[model samples]
Target: MLKEETVRALEQTARQLRVEILKMLNTAKSGHTGGSLSAIDALTALYFHQMRHDPSNPKWEDRDRFVLSKGHAAPALYACLAEAGYFSRDDLKTLRRFGSHLQGHPDMNKTPGVEVCTGSLGQGLSQAVGLAIASKLAGRSARIYSLLGDGEVQEGQIWEATMAAAHFKLDNLCVILDHNGLQIDGEVEKVMNVGPLGPKFLSFNWHVLEVDGHDIQAICQALENADETEGRPTMIIARTVKGKGVPFFEHKASYHGVPPSDDELTRALEHLGHS
Candidate 1:
């Protein structure tokens, strides 16, 4: 069982990451806000508590890999990387600016901790599949994790990669769905029904786990289970609210790519317990 103190710390860290993501988007005045907010909790649990990585040695041979399959949520990944000490937190404000490493998507060559350039809807999972295959072939214990948006799964490539991972029995691979329901256009169901997600993955021969994405403890437990299980990959469906911590943005697809204005940022900061 996860300790209470540890759960509290993870929860606190997640909230902090959310605030930083909002700040980065607000500073850039252009970025994916809803998806970023939705993903920070899972990203936080990965960087802060789960993945084995050296911020100083990003290319460490044994380090676990992380891929943001839903590349639009780059702000969340960037914020988590900064908080994990990959780079200065100050760099977050440079997001989307010309000459900045923090581009609109996760660019591998540009970002120290980003493993691949991912923004195209369905390509990230394929990249993760390749990483997992490489790790297994090299007899490396390093695990590869990919976080995908529910909406992004509408892409055919996601299913192709899913089949490949299971076929290879890439037990070291784990994929997480930030199932926040809403996408840029509207709710995921109305846009593209990806429902019965758990059964779908199960049928594909994966170990499936579902958790409330906002619940840090549940997320940690699900990830721990994934690490212990062998023979095939695991897929965690993390149910989340698109604009998670901030009341004004919660459940609203309108905020999908809109950064918080000054007034909105103030309210969001307060809600996240920022002083």
Candidate 2:
């Protein structure tokens, strides 16, 4: 569980992550912004308050693993990793640049802290299931966490992986769904609705929890509860706004993958009290 002081610290870290995310997106000129911002708080809570990871020993066998299945939100993951001391914050400016480790989508082979190379939607849950099975077979107590997008869950593979995870009874695995209700084209319901997400996961024999994605306290609680759950994988359905914190962008479909212009960035930073 996270102490009050730790939660405060994480709030600061989340703010820093948001700043880095904006800078990185501005530098890249091409990346998902809305989704990334929406998931930042949850990522902050996990890397800063919940996960057992080692920055100096990225490949430590006993360390917890995290997979950003919603690969388009790589900026959030990269920012969290940097704040957690996995890499230098300077590297963030190079995001999506030619030959930079910070690619548009996470590349595990190139990035120190990323566990899986994910960008194709619906594949991350499968990868997490494999990691969980491996940990169990190796007699390791480390847990595995995967963050997925609600729109991505429309893919058939996710449900298939969900079935496999329950079949294997990988209680050490936790899946978080960023339910922001927006996709690239338009609202998630208009693109390809994946509603009743909680019931769907429950029917698949997984433990399902719901929380506000922006609430760090709720995020920590869901994670802690996942640790206590037995005999099944846990899925957290986190309802979130597309562009949390930035008022002009919140729930705005145009900001999904669009970067803020110089003027817009300035206004956004001002709104966030960065100025």
Q: State which candidate has the highest TM-score.
A: 1
Candidate 2 matches the true fold with a TM-score of 0.98
- Deviation of model 1 at 224, angstroms: 0.7
Clashes of 1: 0
For model 1, state the Cα shift of residue 132 in Å: 0.3
Residues 1-275, model 2: lDDT tens digits: 57788888888889888988988898888899999999999999899889999999999999999989999999999999888888999999999999899899999999999999999999988999999999999999999999999889999999899999999999999989999999988999988778889999999999999999988989999999999999999999999999898899899888998987788788888888898
What is the per-residue lDDT of model 1 for residues 104-150, given as tens digits with 9 covering 90 to 100?
99999999899999999999999999999999889899999999999
Candidates' C-alpha lDDT: 0.93, 0.92
Candidate 2 clashes between residue pairs 3 or more apart in a chain or in different chains: none
Off by over 4 Å in 2: none
**225 Cα displacement, candidate 1 (Å):** 0.6
**Residue runs of model 1 more than 4 Å from their true location after superposition:** none
Local distance difference test, candidate 2: 0.92
